[model samples]
Target: MQAGCTGCRSKADTFDIAMAFQPIVDAETGRPFAYEALVRGSNGEGAYDVLSQVTPENRYAFDQQCRVTAIELAVAAGIIDTGARLSINFLPNAVYSPVACIQLTLKTARATGFPPDRLIFEFTENEEMADTSHVKTIVETYRKMGFATAIDDFGAGHAGLGLLAKFQTDLIKLDMDLIRGVDTSLPRRMIIESVVRLCENLGITVIAEGIETVAEYEALRAIGVRYIQGYLLARPGFRTLPEITLPGGSIAAAA
Candidate 1:
């Protein structure tokens, strides 16, 4: 179904599906680790599109499909078990929908025999949130329902530490920019270190995103960042879990 770009024009029916991988490490070991699921789309012309364009009304539908497809693919490949968590992104507006995306997620988990705790919803930082009070209520509600919540691209936008304080997030993914020059910039390292300390004090886990080099990985590890995701680890693809291994002989499928 084609949707109007502006006004009421129609668009294409095909939505592309591509996967991006983010490493989820063992909090204690700081190792190359389990991969999180990312969804992407391609227009019929072969250009990749930003997921944000999908209307909030349709965002959950698209993302939930990706989650289910990823899980089914993993299961058919005999990789991921019902025990593994599948992290998916959700737009803020989805939170306001009467059928909140969280409910769809819980349903998917139940149908697949995946524990609710095994599903993590990563909300983007770019969208304008509806109401902080309502957002926090939804987040806490999800947590109480056994699902984990994370603020994607945490340090990249105005959300900053304020959102961290407001929401009881289970994970905070550091922006890629912070991870890129971390090995050389003392100030950057120090900033991340302080955030790490703050998150630690709050009992929230920190993840360093876009680590494309050994230097970056080691630098993040040194600063107490436990999780890392980047090209150096593994690129996102359709393969099942446990099929890929990390630098230390750790398997992504094992997660």
Candidate 2:
């Protein structure tokens, strides 16, 4: 097994799972800034694949382990500072086992001296939320414990908008699909503009993903979307972090 495979063999049988951080930048700035940790799996071919093929019952377990490993790697690599934040995505169902995951995360953070306040949990809105009340309770518990919460893929999920209204999210990642051609598509542009406005009104920060063109970047910036993550700026990979340069060419290190 590779160095990062902690729970791959014990719980979900054999699989090669790894975690990599994708830098999220301030749209105005071109610098590589905040890192969004992503999980990938390999089937002995030495190539990483999406974890979606795992059985639903075991996927959460694998994901939680990936979160732990990702944080560990970041700390070891010195990519994350005591005050700098790291974002990790989770499925809605993972909240059902919030306590266990929380305990593990806290343990790993303590071991690496990574501050709990610098950790953000991003819940993907793609899956059907099994129980909203339970999820709300779980999110509230984590919030009180000093972890930031975010809703991922906001514009393409079943409960995307509804979840945003119900939960107090520190961040909302705009679905890439919704943003792909937003620069030229009037209808899509309008939808994104409205969502951006709504998020601003709610005092929530918005992050536009899958940005691959200068036009898309400019359009998103014009509409007041602040943070962005996509191939246009930087592909997700392991390397020395890059300085983020704003649209106007002002560069700054990650805070």
Candidate 3:
């Protein structure tokens, strides 16, 4: 095993980190559907500041720490009281074994009083996977454990459709590149509309990420985008859950 994998399994920490939460809003009700826990420096620095320190020997430990710390902080932030899911990013490559690696996460969740079913483990599609079969195993295992699974930055990665074909995740996050200026780009609208339709058919929820303006929000809402996460709704609140500011007159979708 690599040195990092060994430390990852041990989950011994040599770094100090913190979390920032960004809410993913329900387009219909304008309520927070979930809060994604983004990593940051303990002093509230940007993600890059903390991520830049990660090395091969600490990749596993970093990944494990992220899960425990996010859950612990979210509980302190009262996320469970809001009835929103806690969405956490996980590294597939760092996982030595799904069942073995998840013990710490399970313990943290229990200790923090966060329900296991309300957790969402998200994996970025952009990260190259040396073993896709292992990725599938992680996703499936998480699903069976009552936690939701999501693919982040869906269309930006090479694995796009191929990953979807291999694993049936609960959610797919549309890359910011696809959402940027989507209100003005006919090609973008058409492509997004098609993707929405496909995901709807697949029983997978789609979340439009990186929304920053009313025009973009309105455009996505008009096209039946059900969930959204971005600055237009709220920015990541470092070590806190920032108040969500939804666009005015945002109506709930019909039941």
**Across residues 11-130, which tens digit of lDDT does each residue of candidate 1 receive?**
222245655444465535434334577655532221136454566455545555666655554446443442445676665554443234445555655676665566677786765776
- Local accuracy by lDDT, each model: 0.63, 0.72, 0.88
Off by over 4 Å in 2: 1-15, 28-33, 42-53, 239-255
lDDT of 2 at 226: 80
> Which residue segments of model 1 deviate by more than 4 Å?
1-22, 27-34, 41-47, 50-53, 77-79, 97-100, 242-255
- Candidate ordering by TM-score (highest first): 3, 2, 1
* Top candidate by lDDT: 3
Candidate 3 per-residue lDDT, tens place, 97-207, comes to: 888888889999989899999999999988899999998898889888998999999899869888898877999999999999999999999999999999999999999
Kindly list the per-residue Cα lDDT of model 2 for residues 134-243, writing each as its tens digit.
77877888888998888888888788777777776878889999999888999988998999888888888888988888889889988888888887666666523444
Q: What are the TM-scores, per candidate, against the unseen true structure?
A: 0.79, 0.83, 0.94
- Pairs of residues at least 3 apart in sequence or in different chains that clash in candidate 2: 28-246, 28-247, 29-245, 29-246, 30-245, 30-246, 31-243, 31-244, 31-245, 32-244
TM-score of 2: 0.83
